[model samples]
Target: MDVNTTTGLSAASALTGVEVVERKGAGHPDTLADGVAEAISRAYSRYCLKEFGANLHHNTDKTSLLGGAADVRFGHGELTAPIQVLVNGRITAALGDHTIPVADIVTTAARDYLARALPLLDTPRWVDVRPRLTQASSPGAVNAPDTAEREASRQRWFAPRSLDDLAERHRMFSNDSSAGVAYWPLGIGEQLAVGIEAHLTGEAFRTEHPYYGTDIKVMVVRHGVRVQLTACVPQIARETPDLDTYIARRAQARNLIAELAGTIAPEHHVTVCVNTRDVDTRPELYLTATGSSIESGDEGVVGRGNRANGLISMFRPWSAEGVSGKNPVYHVGKLYNLAAAEAARRLHEETGLDCAVALVSQSGRDLTDPWQAIVQTSGPNAILASRARRVIADVMEDLGTLREQLLDGKLATA
Candidate 1:
């Protein structure tokens, strides 16, 4: 393992100047894709682990949703065309002669996830789950001569005959060459960006304002001491009586969010704007039968929304690796991103300094031991550097247990 610990990270200091952060709610199309893909992976993993005692090789991170046509109005709406969800990925469908019901599992998971994500929509009537799973190897894969060592690789590459063929049962290895990055102590803009969306889409807010939809987007932009928050909150057509009621409800929601922002970042001057594209004369507003824009042809794909941390911070560095549907056992893309954030938070708490952690993993490398780890602190301090190393090492050692948390839905991918 190679670890580089440094201090005096001045460029990563105070959250001054202009910063932008955004968050997509659970019902957003992209987030819906992420949730559906992750649900399928978790379901498949649970079935395999219980049936075969090990999670086989699989990566279902390529799920996407195509928007459907709808005739929405102020009080009632109907989906004119069904939304199609393309579930594309690779999975171990058969173990020797025994076949796994991959299609049933994927379809069930997608439908159940969509039902929960969009409560107002009739999932069976308006949504279609299409599974596109395969067990084929990559084009670059080479078939070596039949040998003792090569036999095991061939069995477990996509289909495992038994636990003996699974190398991860003995040692976890990276599945790809990827990087994960994280920073501790979120800025005010970041806090508001994530907080506003959470508050709007939360259960308490939903109960109080049943008209508000789950498909909400919050963008926070901060320059100097002033902050501007723009939020697009969907209103359920059935719950909302008319345009007058919608306008009043929008105002009330906006006021509440502005108050919440004030409480979240008291030092900054925050202004809240809801549904900026709305026009009173045209009577055009963000209204829908389902709280999500997917009802009206808003296409969404995985990896296009928030990161694993749930906030898209434009001012900070991030990785392109999407963590939603990758295998939790050996997929460093998911494990390392969660670990990096955990390590950064722990380092900041222990050292009282803004810290950033970047982990790079090479394909087939040890899961806990990355190819390189760089730790940067806010200021120069030898003591802090040593502590960061210890904290990072401890966090890496616990990477194996993240699978359980992810399975339990403790980590938010979006």
Candidate 2:
């Protein structure tokens, strides 16, 4: 296939008019679902590897979060009902005669993930986790003839199935095949939006300002060189003494964001707004007992949050496929997304041009080989184009390593 080096307007150049980008914080319900699903998948993979010598066939991507009700006052709040967390999927629960604690493992992983992601949330007190997982049977397991003669005939024709054969068969017959898309060289606006959100909700910021909740969002609107940031941050009720204190904290956060934004892009004029919905007169605030919107009737479903790169870019091509909770080994939905991102990043670095990559994989094909792989660049420079092709080829060659990184938890899928 020929590499198309025809470039479009770079993300930076495309920001001449008003462009908007959004990012969901780590504690947001949809993000929570993604995190929980990935955590469960990782734990299950580890368990299967330790006991069964291979990762099991499981797709735990259907997790959901049902928001809980809460009553908030000036300085405190109470949860009327615990947040309902349901994990739905299929897994290998038994290997030969040994039974794997699938539910227990998933439940523990979910609770631990919530505790880590939303430190302000009293997970045990406000979160109720339920596992609705089942063992995934092979395609013909239930209908296969039980007679010894039939079994002998089947073996004679099929012979002994290897692990790779089983994995390929599972991939071929699975209904969850998907393509992964990513682009590189994020625009200044995109970077600022994602960066500001990360700074505000990051560990250092959280440690300094304990009242700031994990459920924070950042929206960026850029017109030419001017950038505007709107952030929705939840304040923990216990840490806030009253409405006045909350207002003061919000002001401080806003100022800090402006200061940080200036450092990020000094040439651009940046404006910051924090929690615009807050009205002191009405005493309406974004306060939470657990520091998450999930306690306030905001439902979240998996794959509805940010992509693997952590920013939802409207100016660039994006994919809605959720990479988390899919199989780590050969699941193209997961591998191709991560691969495309890396490929785009490398191509941009090597060629100094804005790059976009789309990788599509057919069911049961080799993970490294995509059915349709396209590398689009922002300009038509032959020398740079050649370099971009080399970078993409190198990235494709490294696709096999992605599975290891994913299974080891070294990559962030959410």
TM-score of every model versus the real structure: 0.95, 0.89
Candidate closest to the true structure, highest lDDT: 1
lDDT of 2 by residue, 1-414 (tens): 245455554555454656678899988899999988999998988887887677756778888999998877767877888888898877766654567788788988888888899775678888888888765443443344652234222222122233432434333322334677888788888888778888888899888988888888999989998888999988888788887899899998899889999998788899899999988898888988888899888988888888888888787777888877887766677877888899888877776777788877766455555666677776654335466567666877786588778877788886
Could you tell me which 10 consecutive residues in candidate 2 have the lowest summed lDDT? 151-160
In model 2, the runs with Cα more than 4 Å from the true position are 1-5, 13-18, 136-165, 169-177, 382-390
Q: Per-residue lDDT for 1-414 in model 1, tens only?
A: 677887765342244777788999888999999999899999999888888878888999998999898788877877899999998989999776778899998988898999988877788898898888888765445656663255447435687766777777776778778999998888878888878888888888888888889899999888877899999988988888788999999998899999999898888899889999999789888988889899888988888999989988887878887788999988888888889999989988987888789989998888888898888877666334567668878988887578888887777777
Model 2: how far residue 364 lies from native, Å = 2.4
Note the Cα lDDT for every prediction shown. Answer: 0.84, 0.77
* Local lDDT at 355 for model 2: 77
lDDT measured at residue 278 in model 1 versus the true structure, 0 to 100: 95
